[model samples]
Target: MSGSRGIVGEKWSQKILWICAIGSAISLYLVGVERQTQNRFQKMADDLDDIDYSEKSGGDGT
Candidate 1:
């Protein structure tokens, strides 16, 4: 009886550990995706800042 209970407990613990590991992996993946998106937006904003909009407007409408 005691041996059976120990085996059951171990199985439950292993299942819980697997669940936690999967959750952690998913969380990491989401964080990486968010970071990449933020970096892309930051780069786009920087490129826009580098543009000479004033020159393109023909020197303040002549």
Candidate 2:
């Protein structure tokens, strides 16, 4: 019946919407994680730069 077909179509639409939402969430999470990782590494590099490496490397011969 036409009504039954409409019900089936509605279910499929809901499933597709759920899939898209989940995919978007995962994408956003991955992007955020990547940005955090980059920031962490940048902070570490800044911390290293703040140290006096010249005094410690004097005996290393360059």
Candidate 3:
């Protein structure tokens, strides 16, 4: 476009673009991996509020 103009340096522009592309790809991969952890937590449902203190060390101070 005539309105958008930049003095392109082969070294800086190419390196920056490559880094941005890799960062976006890694972020997407991490998001996909995190979905499994979210599912595991969701399976707990209402039991999340039930803390089992009786199993603690010294059996909850007897």
Best by lDDT: 1
lDDT of 2 by residue, 23-42 (tens): 99999999999999999999
User: Per-candidate TM vs. native?
Assistant: 0.80, 0.75, 0.52
Off by over 4 Å in 2: 52-62
Deviation (Å) of 28 in candidate 1: 0.7
Measured with C-alpha atoms, the lDDT of residue 4 in candidate 1 is 100
The TM-score ranking, best first, is 1, 2, 3
Off by over 4 Å in 1: 52-62
Candidate 3, lDDT over the whole model: 0.70
What's the true lDDT of residue 37 in model 1?
Answer: 100
Candidate whose TM-score is highest:
1
Ten-residue region with minimum lDDT total, candidate 3: 46-55
lDDT tens readout by residue for model 1, 1-62: 99999999999999999999999999999999999999999999876655656568665533
lDDT of 1: 0.88
- TM-score of candidate 2 against the unseen true structure: 0.75
